[model samples]
Target chain A: MNIKPLGDRVVIKKIEVEEKTKGGIVLPNSAKEQPQMAEVLAVGPAIANDEKRKDEIKVGDKVIFSKYAGTEVKLDGEEYTILKLNDILAVVE
Target chain B: MNIKPLGDRVVIKKIEVEEKTKGGIVLPNSAKEQPQMAEVLAVGPAIANDEKRKDEIKVGDKVIFSKYAGTEVKLDGEEYTILKLNDILAVVE
Candidate 1:
């Protein structure tokens, strides 16, 4: 990505919601809520004086973020969300 | 006044919008947008490693905060807004 996130911000790509159930039933798009799960594409530098928060999120990590917490951006015809570190609720284990 | 803000949060009471213009003409409520100015009532402890941010805001200071940036709260029948430091736009002179 050409864009670099600055100051405790993260760039993420939303993971597409699964369209099929395990039982082979297809689900309609309207039936699924917007997915909160995202993959970390790039992470900004840590804020000064916050050592513990540094390295907690790394590229390729799957994370769950709060709904309505990020700014959406379009780059190279692809969509991404930029979020503050505080917006990330948890790392998907 | 009894509720304490936590984790870099600040409690503020919105300053009422002026109802009269300098020319002494009365203005209707609809003529005014929600005021962003407020009086700082209380402040929470600073986050670790951010000493510069500490003491930047204090009780009794007049401040301007970002619109839609705080949580509305009620205490003892009075309304207040709890906002993070990041939501505070500037300290009014």
Candidate 2:
């Protein structure tokens, strides 16, 4: 699906968490904190500046995002969200 | 206290949640979701771009952030974190 964000928003796909615990025990979904990780799929036009410069984030970068930043939806068998670029917590190197 | 962030990082003071619920029920620390909100205290020099542009966030902007984004520290009786600007979830209006 071609997902695009408006303004400084970004579209992200949540990265699923592993089902196993550190000690090798299988964990139920309810036992884990929702993983705050994502894969960037699209970014909006950068916030404009007085100098008419535009900065943009690239697609396909792995990012760490807040657990609650955007409205969530499932499209084409995948989950995605439209969030502000500033809502992204950090870009994972 | 004076705090400065390195690179795209920002220094934020965690906003304290109300100890009581809107229904007038007192809530213990353990019973509430950790408030993922902060007040921006300082911002780092903006990341450099090929265009030599630096976009900086201003001080005193109340922001909503993730529950876990940066290393926590206490400076002069206040708790703060040095988090990358990308870690900020959204600039709360």
State which candidate has the highest lDDT: 1
lDDT assessment of candidate 1: 0.75
C-alpha positional error of residue A28 in candidate 2 after TM-score superposition, expressed in Å = 3.9
Give the top-scoring candidate (TM-score).
2
- Pull out the clashing pairs in model 1: none
lDDT of 2 by residue, B5-89 (tens): 4346677888878788889998887798877888887665454432342443568888988778776654345666768777787
Regions of candidate 2 where Cα sits further than 4 Å from its true position:
A46-56, B1-8, B11-93
In model 2 chain A, the worst 10-residue window by lDDT is A47-56
- C-alpha positional error of residue A3 in candidate 1 after TM-score superposition, expressed in Å: 44
| CA-based DockQ, model 1 | 0.02
Model 2: docking quality category: incorrect
